[model samples]
Target: MNDDMTHEPSDTTGPRRLTRTRDGRMITGVCSGAAAYFNVDPTLVRIGAAVVTILTSGAGILLYAAAVLLIPEEGKDVSIAQELINKQTSRN
Candidate 1:
């Protein structure tokens, strides 16, 4: 008769994806998206990126740029090649 016993466990095997946040974003929501995906604070991710950028002579900038291009905005569909093909097929 315990409520906790009646509750089902959440799915832990779901696909983990990174996408830009619609809110709590600064530049392009890269850091915020990463933080949300990783369950960390956005500030921490930003600080880590800053430190990495400083220590790695701008490598962080390149990584950030790649993330911006690759990570889709939240509430938007992922348009990677497979998805694109699926979309094209579904519309037919």
Candidate 2:
């Protein structure tokens, strides 16, 4: 008697999400991004960001949300910022 088994390779894909980080100062994607990048809890980064924002009287809240709308979701294969654009460009 003989037995054989085959398995397909697993796919490698990074999670894509809007970051609230200082990259653009729009929101608090920094923490989320960091968590994904370094495998850390995003809450820690958020707390750190909050502590820093204390000096500014919670100005970071507005900035964090703004970042959510600004930053683009990460791509599956390639990890890079797609960027947010307002006006559509004319195709040449």
TM-score of each: 0.68, 0.43
lDDT tens per residue, model 2, 1-92? 22222111122364434333333233435556655455455566668778868977988777665555555444332223332222223332
Candidate that would win on TM-score: 1
Q: Which pairs clash in the backbone of model 1?
A: none
> How accurate locally, in lDDT, is each candidate?
0.76, 0.48
What is the lDDT for 67 in model 2?
A: 53
Q: Kindly report which residue stretches of model 2 are placed more than 4 angstroms away from their true locations once superposed.
A: 1-30, 75-92
Q: Which portions of model 1 show Cα errors greater than 4 Å?
A: 1-14, 79-92
Which of the numbered candidates is closest to the native, going by highest lDDT?
A: 1
- Cα error of candidate 2 at position 90, Å: 4.9
Poorest stretch of ten by lDDT in candidate 1: 3-12
